[model samples]
Target: MDVRDEAVTIPASEVLLPADLLVPAEPVGAVLFAHGSGSSRHSPRNVAVAHQLNRAGFGTVLVDLLTPAEDEVDAVTAELRFDIGLLADRLAGIVDWLATERPFGTTPVGLFGASTGAAAALVAAARRPDLVQAVVSRGGRPDLAGSALAQVRAATLLLVGGLDEQVITLNEQALDQLTSRAELRVIPGATHLFEEPGTLDQVAEAAADWFHDHLHPQPASA
Candidate 1:
Protein backbone atom coordinates (compact mmCIF):
# COMPACT_ATOMS: atom_id res chain seq x y z
CA MET A 1 0.00 0.00 0.00
CA ASP A 2 1.09 3.55 -0.75
CA VAL A 3 2.08 5.53 2.32
CA ARG A 4 0.13 8.75 2.81
CA ASP A 5 1.73 11.91 4.14
CA GLU A 6 0.54 14.77 6.31
CA ALA A 7 2.19 17.81 7.84
CA VAL A 8 2.03 18.07 11.63
CA THR A 9 3.00 21.41 13.16
CA ILE A 10 4.07 20.95 16.77
CA PRO A 11 4.42 24.08 18.82
CA ALA A 12 7.76 24.67 20.40
CA SER A 13 8.79 27.70 22.49
CA GLU A 14 8.36 30.41 19.87
CA VAL A 15 8.20 28.26 16.77
CA LEU A 16 6.79 24.98 15.49
CA LEU A 17 8.43 21.72 14.47
CA PRO A 18 7.52 20.75 10.94
CA ALA A 19 7.01 16.99 11.17
CA ASP A 20 6.02 14.68 8.41
CA LEU A 21 3.41 12.10 9.43
CA LEU A 22 3.70 8.94 7.38
CA VAL A 23 0.50 6.91 7.50
CA PRO A 24 0.05 3.39 6.34
CA ALA A 25 -3.13 1.86 4.91
CA GLU A 26 -4.01 0.14 8.18
CA PRO A 27 -1.70 1.34 10.87
CA VAL A 28 -1.62 -0.68 14.08
CA GLY A 29 0.53 1.77 16.00
CA ALA A 30 2.45 5.07 15.78
CA VAL A 31 6.11 5.85 16.33
CA LEU A 32 7.47 9.25 17.32
CA PHE A 33 11.04 9.44 16.02
CA ALA A 34 13.99 11.24 17.57
CA HIS A 35 16.88 11.37 15.09
CA GLY A 36 20.54 11.69 16.04
CA SER A 37 22.25 14.98 16.91
CA GLY A 38 23.31 15.76 13.35
CA SER A 39 20.39 13.96 11.75
CA SER A 40 16.88 15.18 11.10
CA ARG A 41 13.73 13.97 9.40
CA HIS A 42 15.86 14.07 6.28
CA SER A 43 18.20 11.25 7.26
CA PRO A 44 18.06 8.64 4.53
CA ARG A 45 18.60 5.72 6.87
CA ASN A 46 15.77 6.80 9.14
CA VAL A 47 13.51 7.65 6.21
CA ALA A 48 14.11 4.24 4.67
CA VAL A 49 13.34 2.51 7.94
CA ALA A 50 10.21 4.58 8.31
CA HIS A 51 9.10 3.22 4.96
CA GLN A 52 9.74 -0.30 6.19
CA LEU A 53 7.71 0.33 9.33
CA ASN A 54 4.91 1.83 7.30
CA ARG A 55 4.80 -1.24 5.12
CA ALA A 56 4.54 -3.28 8.28
CA GLY A 57 1.34 -1.39 9.26
CA PHE A 58 2.68 1.32 11.49
CA GLY A 59 2.61 5.13 11.22
CA THR A 60 5.72 7.25 11.66
CA VAL A 61 6.30 10.80 12.84
CA LEU A 62 9.77 12.08 12.01
CA VAL A 63 10.10 15.42 13.75
CA ASP A 64 13.09 17.69 13.92
CA LEU A 65 14.40 17.62 17.49
CA LEU A 66 15.79 21.13 17.11
CA THR A 67 14.22 24.12 15.41
CA PRO A 68 16.00 25.88 12.56
CA ALA A 69 17.46 28.46 14.92
CA GLU A 70 18.31 25.89 17.57
CA ASP A 71 19.97 23.70 14.94
CA GLU A 72 22.00 26.64 13.66
CA VAL A 73 23.27 27.40 17.15
CA ASP A 74 24.12 23.75 17.83
CA ALA A 75 25.86 23.48 14.48
CA VAL A 76 28.30 26.27 15.33
CA THR A 77 28.55 25.85 19.10
CA ALA A 78 27.95 22.07 19.00
CA GLU A 79 26.66 21.97 22.51
CA LEU A 80 22.89 21.55 22.73
CA ARG A 81 22.50 17.96 21.56
CA PHE A 82 24.24 16.75 24.68
CA ASP A 83 21.62 18.46 26.80
CA ILE A 84 19.54 15.30 26.81
CA GLY A 85 17.27 16.64 29.55
CA LEU A 86 15.93 19.43 27.39
CA LEU A 87 15.53 17.25 24.33
CA ALA A 88 13.65 14.66 26.32
CA ASP A 89 11.40 17.33 27.78
CA ARG A 90 10.50 18.48 24.30
CA LEU A 91 9.78 14.89 23.29
CA ALA A 92 7.49 14.42 26.29
CA GLY A 93 5.67 17.60 25.38
CA ILE A 94 4.99 16.20 21.92
CA VAL A 95 3.59 13.01 23.39
CA ASP A 96 1.27 14.93 25.69
CA TRP A 97 0.10 17.06 22.83
CA LEU A 98 -0.70 13.96 20.81
CA ALA A 99 -3.12 12.85 23.50
CA THR A 100 -4.86 16.18 24.01
CA GLU A 101 -4.67 17.60 20.49
CA ARG A 102 -7.12 17.12 17.65
CA PRO A 103 -5.33 15.01 15.04
CA PHE A 104 -3.46 12.49 17.17
CA GLY A 105 -5.67 11.85 20.15
CA THR A 106 -4.77 8.69 22.07
CA THR A 107 -2.79 6.88 19.40
CA PRO A 108 -0.68 3.96 20.56
CA VAL A 109 2.73 5.61 20.83
CA GLY A 110 6.27 4.26 20.49
CA LEU A 111 9.72 5.85 20.27
CA PHE A 112 12.30 5.23 17.53
CA GLY A 113 15.58 6.95 18.22
CA ALA A 114 19.20 6.86 17.09
CA SER A 115 22.49 8.35 18.28
CA THR A 116 21.93 11.17 20.76
CA GLY A 117 18.25 11.08 20.05
CA ALA A 118 18.10 7.68 21.66
CA ALA A 119 19.03 9.28 24.93
CA ALA A 120 16.19 11.74 24.59
CA ALA A 121 13.76 9.02 23.61
CA LEU A 122 14.60 6.96 26.68
CA VAL A 123 14.34 9.98 28.92
CA ALA A 124 10.99 10.93 27.49
CA ALA A 125 9.66 7.43 28.00
CA ALA A 126 10.93 7.42 31.54
CA ARG A 127 9.27 10.74 32.29
CA ARG A 128 5.94 9.72 30.81
CA PRO A 129 5.50 6.03 31.37
CA ASP A 130 1.78 6.14 30.67
CA LEU A 131 2.17 7.53 27.17
CA VAL A 132 5.08 5.76 25.51
CA GLN A 133 4.46 2.02 25.10
CA ALA A 134 7.80 0.86 23.69
CA VAL A 135 11.18 2.05 22.41
CA VAL A 136 13.62 0.92 19.69
CA SER A 137 17.02 2.44 19.15
CA ARG A 138 19.49 1.89 16.31
CA GLY A 139 23.21 2.37 16.89
CA GLY A 140 22.38 4.74 19.74
CA ARG A 141 24.15 6.39 22.63
CA PRO A 142 21.68 5.23 25.26
CA ASP A 143 24.27 5.99 27.94
CA LEU A 144 23.27 9.61 27.67
CA ALA A 145 19.81 8.78 28.98
CA GLY A 146 21.40 9.18 32.40
CA SER A 147 19.38 8.82 35.62
CA ALA A 148 16.17 8.82 33.64
CA LEU A 149 16.90 5.18 32.90
CA ALA A 150 15.59 4.05 36.27
CA GLN A 151 12.14 5.39 35.48
CA VAL A 152 11.52 3.87 32.06
CA ARG A 153 8.74 1.34 32.59
CA ALA A 154 8.08 0.69 28.91
CA ALA A 155 9.71 -2.15 27.03
CA THR A 156 12.89 -1.03 25.28
CA LEU A 157 15.09 -2.69 22.69
CA LEU A 158 18.53 -1.33 21.94
CA LEU A 159 20.19 -2.40 18.68
CA VAL A 160 23.91 -1.84 18.68
CA GLY A 161 26.58 -2.64 16.10
CA GLY A 162 28.86 -5.59 16.81
CA LEU A 163 31.95 -3.94 15.37
CA ASP A 164 31.36 -0.73 17.29
CA GLU A 165 33.06 -1.98 20.41
CA GLN A 166 33.12 1.35 22.23
CA VAL A 167 29.36 1.95 21.93
CA ILE A 168 28.65 -1.67 22.77
CA THR A 169 30.48 -1.19 26.05
CA LEU A 170 28.60 2.03 26.72
CA ASN A 171 25.27 0.34 26.04
CA GLU A 172 26.18 -2.39 28.49
CA GLN A 173 26.94 0.17 31.15
CA ALA A 174 23.65 1.95 30.56
CA LEU A 175 21.80 -1.35 30.73
CA ASP A 176 22.54 -1.43 34.43
CA GLN A 177 20.66 1.83 34.95
CA LEU A 178 17.54 0.74 33.11
CA THR A 179 14.91 -0.87 35.27
CA SER A 180 12.58 -1.43 32.35
CA ARG A 181 12.27 -4.63 30.39
CA ALA A 182 15.15 -4.03 28.02
CA GLU A 183 17.39 -6.04 25.72
CA LEU A 184 20.42 -5.19 23.62
CA ARG A 185 20.90 -6.83 20.25
CA VAL A 186 24.29 -6.54 18.61
CA ILE A 187 24.27 -6.82 14.84
CA PRO A 188 27.26 -8.80 13.66
CA GLY A 189 29.60 -7.24 11.10
CA ALA A 190 27.83 -3.90 11.48
CA THR A 191 29.39 -0.60 12.38
CA HIS A 192 27.92 2.35 14.26
CA LEU A 193 25.54 3.26 11.44
CA PHE A 194 24.74 -0.31 10.46
CA GLU A 195 25.16 0.91 6.87
CA GLU A 196 26.66 -2.41 5.85
CA PRO A 197 24.64 -4.42 3.36
CA GLY A 198 21.50 -6.05 4.83
CA THR A 199 22.46 -4.98 8.35
CA LEU A 200 19.91 -2.18 8.55
CA ASP A 201 17.19 -4.55 7.46
CA GLN A 202 17.95 -6.61 10.52
CA VAL A 203 17.50 -3.54 12.65
CA ALA A 204 14.15 -2.88 10.97
CA GLU A 205 12.96 -6.41 11.56
CA ALA A 206 13.94 -6.31 15.22
CA ALA A 207 12.15 -3.00 15.61
CA ALA A 208 9.00 -4.35 13.98
CA ASP A 209 8.89 -7.33 16.29
CA TRP A 210 9.43 -5.25 19.40
CA PHE A 211 6.62 -2.88 18.56
CA HIS A 212 4.36 -5.75 17.61
CA ASP A 213 4.90 -7.31 20.99
CA HIS A 214 4.29 -4.18 23.03
CA LEU A 215 1.86 -2.08 21.02
CA HIS A 216 -1.85 -2.22 21.84
CA PRO A 217 -3.47 -5.16 20.14
CA GLN A 218 -6.94 -5.64 18.71
CA PRO A 219 -9.59 -6.80 21.13
CA ALA A 220 -9.80 -10.23 19.64
CA SER A 221 -6.04 -10.62 19.49
CA ALA A 222 -5.50 -9.32 22.97
Candidate 2:
Protein backbone atom coordinates (compact mmCIF):
# COMPACT_ATOMS: atom_id res chain seq x y z
CA MET A 1 0.00 0.00 0.00
CA ASP A 2 1.13 3.53 -0.72
CA VAL A 3 1.96 5.83 2.16
CA ARG A 4 0.41 9.30 2.43
CA ASP A 5 2.40 12.17 3.86
CA GLU A 6 1.17 15.43 5.35
CA ALA A 7 2.63 18.53 6.95
CA VAL A 8 1.08 19.50 10.28
CA THR A 9 1.41 22.09 12.96
CA ILE A 10 0.56 21.13 16.57
CA PRO A 11 0.16 23.49 19.48
CA ALA A 12 2.43 22.76 22.42
CA SER A 13 2.74 24.93 25.51
CA GLU A 14 2.04 28.13 23.61
CA VAL A 15 4.38 27.22 20.74
CA LEU A 16 3.45 25.96 17.32
CA LEU A 17 5.51 22.92 16.54
CA PRO A 18 6.01 21.85 12.94
CA ALA A 19 5.72 18.18 12.14
CA ASP A 20 5.70 15.74 9.25
CA LEU A 21 3.12 12.96 9.41
CA LEU A 22 2.91 9.80 7.30
CA VAL A 23 0.12 7.27 7.32
CA PRO A 24 -0.53 4.07 5.42
CA ALA A 25 -3.95 3.27 3.95
CA GLU A 26 -4.61 1.23 7.10
CA PRO A 27 -2.32 1.92 9.97
CA VAL A 28 -1.84 -0.37 12.95
CA GLY A 29 -0.72 2.40 15.26
CA ALA A 30 0.94 5.81 15.40
CA VAL A 31 4.42 6.67 16.62
CA LEU A 32 5.36 10.21 17.64
CA PHE A 33 9.08 10.94 17.39
CA ALA A 34 10.84 13.23 19.86
CA HIS A 35 14.28 14.06 18.51
CA GLY A 36 17.43 14.54 20.51
CA SER A 37 19.29 17.74 21.29
CA GLY A 38 19.93 19.98 18.28
CA SER A 39 17.72 17.90 16.02
CA SER A 40 14.24 18.36 14.54
CA ARG A 41 11.66 16.74 12.32
CA HIS A 42 14.13 17.14 9.43
CA SER A 43 16.71 14.80 11.01
CA PRO A 44 17.82 12.32 8.37
CA ARG A 45 18.38 9.55 10.88
CA ASN A 46 14.91 9.86 12.42
CA VAL A 47 13.34 10.25 8.99
CA ALA A 48 14.85 6.89 8.07
CA VAL A 49 13.30 5.23 11.11
CA ALA A 50 9.94 6.87 10.42
CA HIS A 51 10.04 5.44 6.90
CA GLN A 52 10.64 2.00 8.30
CA LEU A 53 7.73 2.36 10.70
CA ASN A 54 5.48 3.58 7.90
CA ARG A 55 6.39 0.50 5.85
CA ALA A 56 5.37 -1.61 8.83
CA GLY A 57 1.91 0.01 8.72
CA PHE A 58 2.51 2.29 11.66
CA GLY A 59 1.75 5.97 11.08
CA THR A 60 4.50 8.30 12.20
CA VAL A 61 4.69 11.94 13.30
CA LEU A 62 8.11 13.58 13.41
CA VAL A 63 7.67 16.74 15.46
CA ASP A 64 9.86 19.59 16.53
CA LEU A 65 9.41 20.17 20.25
CA LEU A 66 10.86 23.66 20.06
CA THR A 67 9.59 26.65 18.14
CA PRO A 68 11.93 28.51 15.79
CA ALA A 69 12.50 31.18 18.43
CA GLU A 70 13.13 28.71 21.22
CA ASP A 71 15.40 26.63 19.04
CA GLU A 72 17.59 29.65 18.46
CA VAL A 73 17.95 30.38 22.17
CA ASP A 74 18.46 26.68 22.94
CA ALA A 75 21.21 26.51 20.34
CA VAL A 76 23.03 29.29 22.11
CA THR A 77 22.36 28.29 25.73
CA ALA A 78 22.09 24.52 25.25
CA GLU A 79 19.85 24.59 28.32
CA LEU A 80 16.36 24.08 26.93
CA ARG A 81 17.46 20.89 25.23
CA PHE A 82 18.23 19.33 28.61
CA ASP A 83 15.21 20.65 30.45
CA ILE A 84 13.36 17.37 30.77
CA GLY A 85 10.31 18.87 32.52
CA LEU A 86 9.74 21.44 29.79
CA LEU A 87 10.29 18.93 27.03
CA ALA A 88 7.99 16.40 28.66
CA ASP A 89 5.23 18.98 29.09
CA ARG A 90 5.47 19.83 25.40
CA LEU A 91 5.35 16.16 24.45
CA ALA A 92 2.33 15.54 26.66
CA GLY A 93 0.58 18.44 24.98
CA ILE A 94 1.29 16.91 21.57
CA VAL A 95 -0.06 13.58 22.75
CA ASP A 96 -3.25 15.28 23.86
CA TRP A 97 -3.47 17.01 20.51
CA LEU A 98 -3.13 13.67 18.72
CA ALA A 99 -5.94 12.22 20.80
CA THR A 100 -8.28 14.98 19.62
CA GLU A 101 -7.28 15.00 15.93
CA ARG A 102 -9.12 13.15 13.18
CA PRO A 103 -8.15 9.63 12.05
CA PHE A 104 -5.16 9.76 14.38
CA GLY A 105 -7.38 10.05 17.46
CA THR A 106 -8.58 6.46 17.27
CA THR A 107 -5.22 4.87 16.65
CA PRO A 108 -2.99 3.63 19.44
CA VAL A 109 -0.08 6.01 20.02
CA GLY A 110 3.59 5.23 20.73
CA LEU A 111 6.72 7.28 21.27
CA PHE A 112 10.17 7.07 19.67
CA GLY A 113 12.72 9.28 21.32
CA ALA A 114 16.45 9.92 20.98
CA SER A 115 19.07 11.48 23.29
CA THR A 116 17.61 13.65 26.02
CA GLY A 117 14.31 13.41 24.24
CA ALA A 118 14.15 9.89 25.62
CA ALA A 119 13.89 11.27 29.12
CA ALA A 120 11.18 13.60 27.97
CA ALA A 121 9.33 10.70 26.37
CA LEU A 122 9.50 8.70 29.56
CA VAL A 123 8.22 11.57 31.60
CA ALA A 124 5.38 12.19 29.17
CA ALA A 125 4.44 8.54 29.22
CA ALA A 126 4.32 8.70 32.99
CA ARG A 127 2.02 11.69 32.80
CA ARG A 128 -0.32 10.37 30.11
CA PRO A 129 -0.61 6.68 30.75
CA ASP A 130 -3.94 6.50 28.95
CA LEU A 131 -2.58 7.86 25.68
CA VAL A 132 0.94 6.47 25.21
CA GLN A 133 0.91 2.77 24.40
CA ALA A 134 4.61 2.11 23.89
CA VAL A 135 7.97 3.84 23.79
CA VAL A 136 11.38 3.30 22.12
CA SER A 137 14.56 5.15 22.89
CA ARG A 138 17.61 5.22 20.62
CA GLY A 139 20.96 6.23 22.08
CA GLY A 140 18.90 8.05 24.70
CA ARG A 141 19.30 9.43 28.17
CA PRO A 142 16.36 7.85 29.96
CA ASP A 143 18.14 8.27 33.28
CA LEU A 144 17.43 11.96 33.23
CA ALA A 145 13.71 11.36 33.84
CA GLY A 146 14.42 11.11 37.59
CA SER A 147 11.75 9.68 39.91
CA ALA A 148 9.10 9.63 37.23
CA LEU A 149 10.92 6.69 35.64
CA ALA A 150 8.94 4.35 37.87
CA GLN A 151 5.63 5.82 36.79
CA VAL A 152 5.76 5.08 33.06
CA ARG A 153 3.30 2.37 32.16
CA ALA A 154 4.18 2.01 28.49
CA ALA A 155 6.08 -0.97 27.19
CA THR A 156 9.52 0.55 26.65
CA LEU A 157 12.51 -0.44 24.54
CA LEU A 158 15.92 1.04 25.19
CA LEU A 159 18.45 0.69 22.36
CA VAL A 160 22.03 1.59 23.08
CA GLY A 161 25.40 1.24 21.36
CA GLY A 162 27.66 -1.30 23.01
CA LEU A 163 30.63 0.94 22.44
CA ASP A 164 28.95 3.64 24.47
CA GLU A 165 29.63 2.08 27.86
CA GLN A 166 28.75 5.03 30.04
CA VAL A 167 25.34 5.37 28.47
CA ILE A 168 24.85 1.62 28.71
CA THR A 169 25.33 1.82 32.48
CA LEU A 170 22.92 4.70 32.73
CA ASN A 171 20.30 2.84 30.71
CA GLU A 172 20.75 -0.16 32.99
CA GLN A 173 20.06 2.00 36.01
CA ALA A 174 17.01 3.53 34.38
CA LEU A 175 15.76 0.11 33.38
CA ASP A 176 15.92 -0.95 37.00
CA GLN A 177 13.75 1.95 38.06
CA LEU A 178 11.11 1.38 35.41
CA THR A 179 8.08 -0.44 36.81
CA SER A 180 6.69 -1.14 33.37
CA ARG A 181 7.69 -3.82 30.87
CA ALA A 182 11.09 -2.70 29.57
CA GLU A 183 14.11 -4.20 27.86
CA LEU A 184 17.58 -3.00 26.92
CA ARG A 185 19.35 -4.02 23.73
CA VAL A 186 22.84 -2.89 22.77
CA ILE A 187 24.18 -2.83 19.22
CA PRO A 188 27.79 -3.88 18.98
CA GLY A 189 30.52 -1.79 17.31
CA ALA A 190 28.32 1.30 17.30
CA THR A 191 29.01 4.60 18.98
CA HIS A 192 26.61 6.94 20.72
CA LEU A 193 25.26 8.07 17.34
CA PHE A 194 24.92 4.54 15.97
CA GLU A 195 26.87 5.78 12.94
CA GLU A 196 28.62 2.49 12.35
CA PRO A 197 27.79 0.35 9.35
CA GLY A 198 24.28 -1.04 9.54
CA THR A 199 23.88 -0.02 13.19
CA LEU A 200 21.05 2.41 12.72
CA ASP A 201 19.24 -0.23 10.69
CA GLN A 202 19.38 -2.51 13.69
CA VAL A 203 17.90 0.20 15.88
CA ALA A 204 15.07 0.80 13.42
CA GLU A 205 14.25 -2.89 13.12
CA ALA A 206 14.19 -3.37 16.86
CA ALA A 207 11.93 -0.36 17.32
CA ALA A 208 9.55 -1.47 14.59
CA ASP A 209 9.23 -4.94 16.07
CA TRP A 210 8.63 -3.59 19.55
CA PHE A 211 5.95 -1.17 18.45
CA HIS A 212 4.25 -3.78 16.30
CA ASP A 213 4.13 -6.26 19.12
CA HIS A 214 2.84 -3.91 21.77
CA LEU A 215 0.98 -1.04 20.15
CA HIS A 216 -2.22 -2.36 18.59
CA PRO A 217 -3.38 -5.84 19.40
CA GLN A 218 -6.16 -7.13 17.17
CA PRO A 219 -9.58 -6.82 18.74
CA ALA A 220 -11.96 -9.76 18.81
CA SER A 221 -14.92 -9.39 16.45
CA ALA A 222 -18.43 -9.51 17.82
**Candidate that would win on TM-score:** 2
| Model 1 C-alpha RMSD to native | 2.6
Query: Model 1: residues >4 Å from true position, as ranges?
Result: 102-105, 217-222
lDDT of each: 0.86, 0.92
Q: Write the per-residue lDDT of candidate 2 for residues 23-88, one digit (tens) a residue.
A: 898888999999999998998999999998898888999999988998999999999899899999
User: In lDDT terms, how accurate is model 2?
Assistant: 0.92
Clashing pairs in 2: none
lDDT of 1 by residue, 1-222 (tens): 777899888974445788998987677888888999777888998988888888888888888878899899999987988889878888888887766772533458899999999999999999888879999989899988878889899899999999999999999998888888899999999999988999999998899899989987424334
TM per prediction: 0.93, 0.96
lDDT of 1 at 139: 87
Candidate number with greatest lDDT? 2
Candidate 1, pairs of clashing residues? none
